[model samples]
Target: MNRDLREFRRLERLCLEQAALSTMDLARTGLLKVADDCRAAAEAIEARSPPRGAFAGAVQALKRAPLAWRVGARS
Candidate 1:
């Protein structure tokens, strides 16, 4: 699960960066799909109850991650 979340974050960052530089429509579309997959993975992890408060908080933060991140804005 942790690995999945980590991968999601990594992919999210990569997608955002690529989106910021991508001028081609096909590349942008592909990045959008990758972003969507990352969100879905995060949502799936958020559905589980973490055993520790810190883990719970992390999960919540992941769930609450701002839209700006997807658009390459610092948040």
Candidate 2:
């Protein structure tokens, strides 16, 4: 997963550079296609990974915590 992310980042950067230098429509379109492909690949990877963030962590912890402990907690 890490390696795939790195590769996608690299390809995305390369495509951006090529797109900038491209003077013709066909070349720019090709670079845009490559960039879109990299974006899709990255999205696919992220979808398979568990959610991240404080809310997600709290939800996960709540799921793992005992029901008695959860109900007994005071605010």
Candidate 3:
């Protein structure tokens, strides 16, 4: 990837990290709005820079499993 794309990827990684933390909090609170916001964060990252190869499946898994359960291999 180009320099600009690499920078964008870095930003997206930050977004995903924040989203993960938010999701954990939302899950504990059981608040739909907060959970939705976290989900939106994930969507925004996907929009700007979709996951590559093995990570593509990981992103999909996050849609189903709880954030805490997203461990092990990339996929």
Best by lDDT: 2
lDDT of 1: 0.77
How many steric clashes between backbone atoms does each model show? 0, 0, 0
Q: List per-prediction Cα lDDT, in the order shown.
A: 0.77, 0.79, 0.55
1 versus 2: better lDDT goes to: 2
Tens digits of per-residue lDDT, candidate 2, 1-75, equal 978988997898899899999999999999998998897687567556686988986775565465447447943
lDDT of 3 by residue, 1-39 (tens): 345545555565555556666648655354444545555
Ranked by TM-score, top first: 2, 1, 3
Write the number of the candidate with greater TM-score, choosing between 1 and 2. 2
Where in model 1 is the C-alpha error above 4 Å? 51-75
Which candidate gets the maximum TM-score versus the true structure?
Answer: 2
Clashing pairs in 3: none
lDDT value, residue 55 of candidate 1: 75
Residue 66's lDDT in candidate 3:
54
